[model samples]
Target: MASSPTIRYGALAQTFHWLTAVLVVTAFILGPEGSEDEVFRGADLGRQAHETLGLAVFVLTAARLLWRLADRRPDPPDVARWMDIASKAVQGALYLLLCAVPLSAVIGTWLEGHPVTLLAGIEVAPMIAASHSLGERVSELHGLLGDTLIWIAGLHAAAALFHHYFLKDTVLVTMLPRWLKK
Candidate 1:
């Protein structure tokens, strides 16, 4: 639990936040090469790695969402009312994207009749019938969502920086690791 009403997040919440951020960023970086069929027609190492990490993102994000719902979040910073609303909206959008991007990829892969190899090499067979056209369309959407996620995540970072540098608030510091705290 937070030590004070507006103090730092619980350790578990902080862990989920940082872990999801890392996995999402990694999955985004590996997306292009991994989604390329030419790079690995029959599960190229890069594609396999991407799929594996994507699955992790999907699972982790779900757990994070659940944790968030069940836990008490720290109160919003003592910013203006509008800033608080904006913060909530942006945070909600980011969470939506965090869940959507990887799930879309999973569906696209399954629709293409490709099995996904999980982190431990556990194979997941495709559930739906193969459809090249539909698969391509979904894949395109997956890519588009990934791009959108990156942009929104950038905006989220910028907002934190704005709070940290301009407002000089704890909004950013609350999420920082202990060593980074002033």
Candidate 2:
């Protein structure tokens, strides 16, 4: 297939971006809101869904990063140098959080002497030695990171909207799927 154009992302990249967004949001919503004990109490459907979606996000992100290595991205829009730097920083942070969030969850669950539960009766046993106290701490960090991810993602979306409306540029449109582009 042809590489992405300087003007816009290819369909595959767009798909990866939008799908990851959807999965993250869905997983966040489904996450159980409670203490580590309550969250790991049982195999509830909501928790299972959240775990499954989180895993999907993690896997999707890994695939996206691999694809990024081989794919050509659209050129950055004309903007202030500071804006470019800020954008790059935000992008890097997002990628880091994408990996960290799920990893924290897995490590925390395992350390707490619990298996990472997913849908369809799939469970991943803990690979590390148990340390309940450390697990609790990591679980708390996971919650904080999850919240941070949402806030950062919101900021990212706001920036895209600003580019589309105020800057009147192709920055937002470039990542949009063909059907969504004008």
Candidate 3:
């Protein structure tokens, strides 16, 4: 069978893949703890950082989406039928949640009249009124999306491990860093 041309996923894809991966993990893990709850009320700075990173992930995901559209990526191996289907489904859901989580935050922030901070370490200017119901709802949705994201990411990671150990294919390597392949 003819094989596809292989190279590191275009630079943009690699950047989006790794950077977004780290940011997603960061935002999902640290976001909840930084919520406006009693426990972290004293650590408002941390909370702010969490919010900033959360917003950053959202924006980066958007950029990644745009980049994805510009570059068409190849599918997984034809031999791994089940893995291909499963990964695609999980990845689709992940993409959905990726957008949903940030959307919820945008809605919540707008409701709360909070400025969307992009981590310039500056003050956030609120666009809507503070203490609004919409903000609360969006915040709740954000939490739910975060939970979903965690599951999808875990499954994705596990699948990569499985691919390496069991499938013995280069599926995972397709996205690996350049140095690792050498």
lDDT of each: 0.79, 0.92, 0.72
Query: Which digits, one per residue and each the tens of the lDDT, describe model 2 over residues 8-117?
Result: 88899999999999999999999998777678787788999999999999999999999999998888788999999999999999999999999999999899999989
- Give the CA lDDT, 0 to 100, for residue 167 in model 3: 78
* Cα misplacement distance, residue 97 of candidate 3 (Å): 1.4
Candidate 3, residue 31: the lDDT equals 65
Off by over 4 Å in 3: 1-4, 32-43, 112-121, 128-131
Lowest lDDT sum, 10 consecutive residues, model 3, at 34-43
Top lDDT prediction, candidate number: 2
Residue 31, candidate 1: alpha-carbon lDDT: 61
TM accuracy, model 3: 0.80
Q: What are the models' TM-scores? A: 0.88, 0.95, 0.80
RMSD of 2: 2.3
Instruction: Tell how far residue 108 is off in model 3, in angstroms.
Output: 1.8
Tens-digit per-residue lDDT, 42-161, candidate 3: 435555666777777778888888888888675556565776678779989988888888778767766766555544445567666677666777777778888888888888888877
Q: Is candidate 2 or candidate 3 better by TM-score?
A: 2
Error of 3 at 81 (Å): 4.0
Cand. 1 TM to true fold: 0.88
